[model samples]
Target: MLIRYSKILLTAALGALILLVAINNVTDYATNYQFVSHVMSMDQVPTGSPLEWRAVTSVTLHRLFYAFIIAVEFSAAALVLAGAWRLLLRRKAEAARFNAAKDVAIAGLALAVGLYLFGFMAVGGEWFQMWRSLPDAEQAAFRFIGCAALVMLFLGQRDD
Candidate 1:
């Protein structure tokens, strides 16, 4: 039971973290948008190189990408919160039933992985070469990915 509650709490905590991050993105839009713009535009990276062509300088596209990122984060937050609620409701059920309640949380965590892995690492890091940028944006993405992945591993453990 203790382990079950711990899982529930951790899941809820992950939901809260994602929710806060989404809220921050919405409330403090320009900050992360700058990160996105810089990464996508590749302006911070040294000019004159074969990779220069990969930069996406269109303002419209920058806003679209930022919006897409926020949307995914918000969705993940909602899913995880719902998953936490489901777990709370089923905390006392048989182990199998309680385990079944984890699906939404898993989905939410997977979305987080996708955001950091696909959006940040693949698109920004490799495609746009955000890692090569002056500020090195890859670190932040790696941190977020690590946190999400760790929580996901913990959430995947079966309750005895």
Candidate 2:
């Protein structure tokens, strides 16, 4: 088990390194991916600047970025289910099953919120209207998911 965890950690480190490298390459190659025509929105743009950064022409790239975000969110949520399955199969600590399940469920909830964020960005609905007009309350309510999951996990882990 220790070796498995070590490998997972190493893989995660390598993934992070790869991402860093990729982002650096993207930054270096920023000019090759643009073909601007007009300013997108002057209302929200800052003025008195040497370089104009309010325009966009990378529609293909934008869609890919959006799709990638959604894919990542879904993948993260699915990982929770995957973790639970892995735990059930390999974890011999019957006393910890509930806690483990709860942890996985919390992970799932986090992923669901990621999905929701993508939805909100894509839909562009009024952030505080047409759905009860309780943005703060909804945010607090969403936070409860992880809190409840954590409580369940801790309670299950307790000796009672």
Index of the highest-TM-score prediction: 1
Q: Model 2: per-residue lDDT, tens digit, 1-160?
A: 4433332333233234324433543564343222111111222233554333433336764445445544554454455445545544544445354344445534544554444443332221132121223245346434533443443343234321
In angstroms, the error of model 1 at 29 is 0.7
What value of lDDT does candidate 2 attain over all alpha carbons? Answer: 0.39
User: What tens-digit string does per-residue lDDT give for candidate 1 at 1-160?
Assistant: 8888888898899899999999999999999999889888888667678888888889999999999999999999999899999999999999899889999999999998899889988988888887775335677778888888888888889876
lDDT of 1: 0.88
TM-score of 2: 0.35
Instruction: Tell me which residue pairs clash in candidate 1.
Output: none
TM-scores for candidates 1 onward, in order: 0.94, 0.35
Lowest summed lDDT across 10 adjacent residues in model 1 is found at 131-140
Against the unseen true structure, what C-alpha lDDT does each candidate score? 0.88, 0.39
Stretches of candidate 1 above 4 Å error? 134-136
